[model samples]
Target: MYRLLLQNALRPSLQKRRMKDIWVWNGMRMTEVDRIMLGLRQRIKQLDENVVILEKEDDRNLYGAISLRIIELELAEILALLDTLNRTTSNYHHLIIETTAQLQDMMDTMVALVKFDKMQVIKKEHENQQIKKDLEKCKNEQKATLPPPTLSPGHCGLGQMVNVSGPKTYSLTAYGTSYSFGAWGRDVNPAPGNDKYWLVVLSSSNVYGHYVRQYSTLSTLLLGLGPTDTYISSSNPTTNTIQGPNMVMYGNALYYNCYYTLSICRFNMTTRTVSTVALPKDAGYNSKFPFGILGKSYDYTDIDFATDESSLYVIYATTGNFGNVVITKVETSTTPVLGETWYTSLYKATATNTFMVCGVLYATRYIDKETEQIFYSFDTKTNEERYDLKIHIRKMQPNIEYLNYDPRDHLLYVYSDAYIVTYEVMFQ
Candidate 1:
């Protein structure tokens, strides 16, 4: 018992002594490291400033290659010192304070370098800006020297209502002409299932809503419109009220929606017959609460599909009784049913809607009222909220009439009464 008491009594004193030694060693080492780091940081800041000045010289900057090598060597020494200090530090609390101070110094130095570099670039580009403005002015002056756009007889020919798909090259079903929008980028994939190219036009005639399909080829339409072998018009025009015929060309089959009943139909390119598939059920229409309305009960302003074109999403608004604007998505491969349907109820004073650039579904909610502005982003993935962006215009001077995202260009296309504008958006 005496021996046990003696061991216990000495343990605390021993531990305290060890701890004191550790603290002292850490303190001395930290003091030296701090001094070294502070001096190195000053050197780094000076070198960084020199780097910015040299960078302005462009080709002359390459002459400072030796100076850059020296700066890199100094930066390496600072990093090595930091690693050593980090390993030697006794506890995280003190280490954090010291590291934070060092990081702040580095950050401030970096920010200064960035600012100086940007200023130099701006100074260099100022001449370019002036030249561009002068060139535009000269072009405008030359506009008075030239004639207006000549209108040929069929310059704006109604080639028939066509849908375009694929890369930079767009396939015009009506003309059977695939043209590249830009000079360099172009790709082609024929509409799925149909070997013979066909022009499909959805006609909203007084008597009936029917789809017109005429067969042609890329060469035939581009060379000359050869005779159409088959013309498939809707046989049962009464029941199938097709509206907002945003036709999509999946592999070989063509698909479009009938808005009123909220049904999607697939047409075989060969047989050319319409059959209904399960999709979102259509909403009842009223008009007082919405900004705009489509003419037919089932016709909608916008319909979008996802990136893979595997999912169909549809949007339409009605306002007469202050009913909700509905948004729906249908997974193409899955059987369309109530169990498979996804929807959101957007109560409206006014709402203008559009899909995301990649067609990952989203709705920008906007309501203009007497007192304040309101907006929200409804994400379809989680059936929850993505609170990043909000659209409010009442408090602002200009009101937005339409919002659309261009998946092709990674641009947000906004249309207002006074101006058409584009904003860059990160396309993930």
Candidate 2:
């Protein structure tokens, strides 16, 4: 019984030690969990702060974008208003200048009339004095040699009635080409400084290729030049061959517009070499349709080639933007280079064709058969537009497809679907 009591006491002591160790281990685990929970709280606070900062930044960026858009809108409005005001002011200034010019013209006309009346009065006085002197001389002659008896009225009537004929009729001999060069002739230009009156005709055929024919005169025989295929060298071999629709000859070189490549092809007659000049970036060409179809159809490239007194020029506009014309002067020596460019508000699509006369651009449109042909001219010298020039075309056709002004003959040539006509341009 004493041993049993000792064993019970030892078991109690062992149980107490085990309980103390378990308590120490749980205390250490509780301290680690508390440290982890505190770190989590601190991380959560930092995340909240970051989110708030990001939200504020986003709001600032959105507000900044909106402010910029508003500024842009305001700036656009201001620019539009400025443009309107400038146009209005320019129109008003033009009106005032025109009115002043008219008034000045009227004053000058009045002065001219007054001077003319004064001169007329002086002239009448001098005439009267001369008449009086003539009468006195006649009287002296009559006195010197007894005046012959006046012829009887009956005899005078008999002589006057012997041969009474109407005034001689007169007729003007019409001057122009009666022969019609077939409709395929795209362009005709007079050779520069040629005594034989050489004409270069640009004609195209699938079989013969795009070629030029040189005629000694419009009436003379034709001599075919090189087919474009023989002369043109493609920059890209995979690309289709370029052909010229319109061409102008300057000196010994011929400049042509290649719609396929959107380039100007220059052929040197002397060297027999072909080179190309790239068109402006804005110059648009329609490649959706085949060349043959496009050439025959109404949808055509707006690019045109022309020559003035000084240099060659390229006239072009974008597709659907034919109202705005851009003209560039081209210099062709060893290579073709674009020179001075001019922008015009004139709509090129409205006209059948345009040509340059003494640096002035002229456009023509077809009206009815009876009405006089109308013309719109833009003078490059003064940058003035005149839309009131009316010209009469005899036996006018319904449609005039091409109108070209030949500076050599000072004649305007009109090409209809069937016939080619020429008119003498008389300037007052």
Give RMSD to native, each candidate.
31.6, 39.4
lDDT (10s digit) by residue, model 1, range 2-21:
22443364456435434644
Candidates in order, TM-scores: namely: 0.35, 0.45
- What tens digits encode model 2's per-residue C-alpha lDDT throughout 158-234? 21001101111111111123322211222234345542322222233211123333434444322223222233343
lDDT of 2 at 138: 45
Candidate 1 — which residues are off by over 4 angstroms? Answer: 1-202, 205-209, 212-241, 259-262, 277-282, 285-310, 316-322, 325-327, 333-339, 345-353, 356-359, 363-377, 384-428
Stretches of candidate 2 exceeding 4 Å from the true structure: 1-209, 221-245, 287-301, 319-322, 369-372, 394-398
Q: What is the C-alpha local distance difference test score of each model?
A: 0.41, 0.48
TM-score between candidate 2 and the true structure: 0.45
lDDT of predicted model 2:
0.48
* Winner by lDDT: 2
